[model samples]
Target chain A: MATKRIVVDPVTRIEGHLRVEAVVENGIITDAFSSGTMVRGLEIILKGRDPRDAWAFTQRACGVCTTVHALASVRTVEDAVGISVPKNAELIRNIMEAALYVQDHVVHFYHLHALDWVDVVSALSADPKETSRIAQSISHWPKSSVGYFKDVATRLKTFVESGQLGIFANGYWGHKAMKLPPEINLLAVAHYLEALEWQKEIVKIHAIFGGKNPHPNYLVGGVPCSINLNEVNAINSERLNHVSKLITDAMQFVNQVYIPDLMAIAPYYKDWGAIGGGMENFLCYGDFPTHGYNQTDSFKFPRGIILGQNLNEVVEVDARDPQQIKEYIKHSWYKYGAGDEAGLHPWEGETEFNFTGPKPPFDQLDVQNKYSWIKTPRWKDKAMEVGPLSRMLVAYAAGVTEVQDIVNDTLARLNVPVGALFSTLGRTAARGLETKLIVGWLKGFFDDLVTNVKAGDTTTFTKEKWEPSSWPQSCEGVGMTEAPRGALAHFIKINSGKIENYQLVVPTTWNASPRDPSGQKSAYETALIGTPIADKDMPLEILRTIHSFDPCLACSVHLYDPDGKHIHDIKVV
Target chain B: MLLLNPEGYMQNTKINTTLILGIGNTLLADEGVGVHVANYLNQKKLPDFVEVVDGGTGSFVLLGIMQNADRVILIDATIDGEKPGTIKRLTPKFSKDYPKTLTAHDIGLKDLLDAFYLLDTVPKVILYAISIAPLAEGLSLELSSEVESAIPEIVDQILKEIE
Candidate 1:
């Protein structure tokens, strides 16, 4: 009957610094505040630099989704200069992007988000033989043998016995909220370890194409890797074969392990299908361009906005229309030139440090004031949720038969209604389904790339319009992509050959933002409202919803601190 | 058995290549010290078998490169409640020996080491942890003066490790 505030600062297993405060009344969260505590002056650092070199610097925004920033940065420059990349280059970029999606989603599901569901300590009690039986019953993955599971169980036992949990140290093991039985928990634990190894093999595609993973190389006009049948250093026949094998391996794992694992785990936690569905409006700047970047119809994932859970009428997304996508910092820790209440288009976006909240180690945030470094980015002044769930729902609504079939089949299999597809479990399931869809598309892209190479089309870069002299004196461009977390856009204003101003509104910035001038709560905050907290102290339920968004504050807000001395230090355990 | 190829450079005749990996964000002030030290070492004429890579906050991707090497020297920014620029060199035998948190990535290099340990492919690892102030909200590309001065010593420590 009493209102109590519970805060989870620096939510572990997420990419960057995030602090969440929720006021719980009668074991239900009534109000919530999401804050991104750090500021990365990445946009500030990009000013006055050559627009061509922007990818190398901007790619450092976050380490996990490394290549997405590079891709978006190069695309931004390309869009500004009006350079159409070669078809071969387009196919190669698509494949690389697909590889990143598979790798990111798999890692997110197993390593990052899975711990919130599967209790690691409970896995020690699971019988290896029973776990193996359940694993085999679910999926046809080859490592589902009792002997293999026994070995995995032994390794996990040793880890638990060693007293040092390492990455698994702070998890709320054996919590009342953990739903999985010991056998299923052991099965998930086995797959979690397998996924770590599986991810390594998938990233080799990036290394083969871009010369490295994490921060892969990208060019404005085209990709950097050239297809040469004879050269050892280039993307030759031998390397292409290896890339082909890796795609097949990734596809098999997604189909055999990832999707099966999601389905197996979804039924147990179907209650989550009714929780954490925030800001039903969804936005996606469709990706995987078949033609050039300008042609939206050629995109595999079509660009659109699905508002208020209305799956029937899908509205077209116009990134160029300044009114459609504007960031409001009314309640964010940023000051706008026009005033605190005014919304600014990213081209005219400004990053001014204005920390107007209580200092660190505080009990509660001044929720009515500036609370987060992330500004509320509204699509036509409406808070829009962007991620796999949004993308999948939009695709399904648009009658993309593949997306529709996957969503329908998944819901049917779980025996949950269509309305249930809008919650936290739905978000997690959507990521798995999207990975499955992307892996299928990767095979087609790889085949198309091979076909282009066989036709003696070795062209990868367009060198004609690369020089600054060939450009207009002033131009503005918006580069948008469906990053692993969600919709990511980078806006660039170029003068002569240099970047005059740059603004990036990443995916998490949309989902994890604070309140706007209209006093509307962010997607994360809205999702947290009415979330039943089983335990106020452990608050694993709050983490379940937040982790579902796959929050990456580094990508959302770039740098921290204007004054070098007063660093906000909050002790996180 | 050093041999000269067409480029006429002395190549290391040793079979096992020692990878010197510098992992951090170069755009972040003191956090980029490992990359700075790596770049400094890259300019020097080291052994051909000694490869220098600026990993730049990469997590599992570095495992492929790490597994290929017989030994590795990793340099990154670490905060252990030490002075801002105090350089600490350690030979970490297990993942627990590595710092609990890293500046840029959530699953730090320690997680990667744990994976390597699980796979039984972990190489001999030596770390040069240049102490930066603990994770905070400040922005600068230039390293603190103390961190900048420790670069030579850090590189020296890495050179000694490889030798």
Candidate 2:
């Protein structure tokens, strides 16, 4: 009967740290506040540095999105210096980006988000034979034998009974809102383990090209992998073939395991198709360039903005236009030179630390005052959602035939209307659908690279403009990439070949930012407003909506607090 | 035609069975002591089986390296009310056995360990937790002088272990 405030800090199973504070009135979320607990550590680390070496450091900023960050950083530096990459280099970069999408999306669904839908405890009681039968009916992924299902159930039972759930430890298991059947849960659990094995293979594309996986090496002018199709220790036919095999494997995994699992899981929770539909504005700085980054029309994802929930018309998005894209520090722990009310574009962005919040070991944030580590990012002073759903909607609206076919086919298969694309289900489904299309694109990029290499053009690097001496005294440029989470971009101002100011408006900064000066909430907070919490203690419903964004606000200081012991993840007050 | 690299992700890095993994954010002052120590060790000579990795903040991507590794020595900063540079060695079998460090990637490391539980191969992992004060304002690539002073002792301990 009374309004209660529920807080889920360090929301588990995400790439980064996210704290969600929801105001529940009469079992439904009336108001919600989302805070990224950690500051953007890279902002201060990257100031007044040589722009050429940024790719290595920026890639370490996020926990999982090293490739995307590296890509953005290099692209920004290249844009600034006017360093044009060879076709082989661009194709290789596309392949790596595409590989990341396949791996990131699948990992998000299984390891990160699937626990919300499929209960591990429930899976323990499932009939292996039935799970195998259901698996066969939906997908032909070879790990669907009855014995395999039985083994998975046994392993899960052993884990659950071990009194140490570890990764599965923080899950709000057996929540009333968790709707998947025992067999389906078991099937999902089986794939969760298998997906981990499959994802490691995907990153080899990064290693083959970038030199390593965790923090791969990157050059400003072009990719590090030089091409020599015949040499044993080069980007030869063997390595290219290896890339091809990874792409083929990814295609099969997405088509068979991921898409089928999504369809199978969607019918059970069609109610979610209407819930957690946040804003009407979506923006995407499209990626996978066919004609190069400058040509938006050649982008496989297609660059554009959809305003007021209009799927028919898309407005142009200009990241460089100082008026078009801007960031505000209001309702955030950052301060701008002009003031809180003024939104500065990325080129003029500031990294002033202004921590003004309640000390930790506290209950809730001062919502009326400054809160959250993420700065509010805006497109022409309007809050916009940017991610897989944003990308899909923009592509589908722009009449990308492949995206349309998949979107239409998915809608028809689920028998849901087009409006359902606005909700939590839509966001989650969009990621899988986009992954399906990207794998196909990955194949095309691979083929194109092979064709070019076979035509005796093995040039992957351009020495022109690679030196800092070639640049003007000062120049500014912006590099945008569609990260697995959303539209991620970096803007840099180079003065005399040194980075005067560097600003990264990441996916999480846009999605998880707090209220603006005008009191407008970002995607994460807005999506949680109407979510009905079945039980206040275990807010499974809240995680469903929040995790849909694939919130990647990581790099939280990994402080080992022994005295101030805080055990619970979701604290309700 | 995926050419099989017998060595794991470390084929790019020096492929080794023994790994000295450092976990931290270099941007933070003392928080990056692990990486600082790893960088210090990377310059020095060590056993051929050992590979020093700046496992900056620990991600799922590091699992590729761990899959091939037989033994891992991890160094990270911890806030346990001890002296700023006090070192504690721990042999953690499961993710639950370690101290609850609060980073999004710390969760990933724990999840990475938990992921190993799902697989048949589990690497033997040892952690050297360096005690330090809580996070402070103003980011710096340089470690605090006090924390920086303790690196030699930590490096000596690591050298003895590898020896």
User: By DockQ thresholds, what CAPRI class is model 1?
Assistant: acceptable
DockQ of each: 0.33, 0.41
Question: How high is the lDDT of residue A395 in model 1?
Answer: 89
Worst 10-residue lDDT window, candidate 1 chain A: A559-568
TM accuracy, model 1: 0.94
RMSD of each: 4.1, 2.6
Per-chain TM-score, chain A, candidate 1: 0.96
Candidate 2 residue lDDT tens string, A1-573: 789999987676665556789999999999999988657657667778899988777876766788888899999988887777888888989988898888889989998789889988889889999999999999878888899999998888888888675666657788888899999999898889889888888887877887665677777877887789888677888787778788888889999999999999999999999999978899999999988777779899999999999999989988999999888888988787798898998888888889999886789899998988888999988999999999999999999998999999999999999999999999999999999889999999999999998998988888898778889999988889999988989998898888888888888888889988899989988888888989998888988998898877664333333333233366777
Off by over 4 Å in 2: A555-568, B1-16, B102-106
Candidate 1 local Cα displacement, residue A160, angstroms: 0.6
Q: Could you tell me the TM-score of chain B in model 1?
A: 0.84
> Model 1 off-target regions past 4 Å?
A38-40, A556-573, B1-15, B99-104, B134-138
lDDT of 2 by residue, B16-45 (tens): 468888887776678778889999998997
> TM-scores, in order shown?
0.94, 0.96
After TM-score superposition, what is the CA distance of residue A430 in candidate 1 from its true location, in Å? 0.5
Specify the poorest-scoring 10-residue window by lDDT in model 2 chain B: B1-10
Deviation from native of the Cα of residue A125 in model 1, angstroms = 1.8
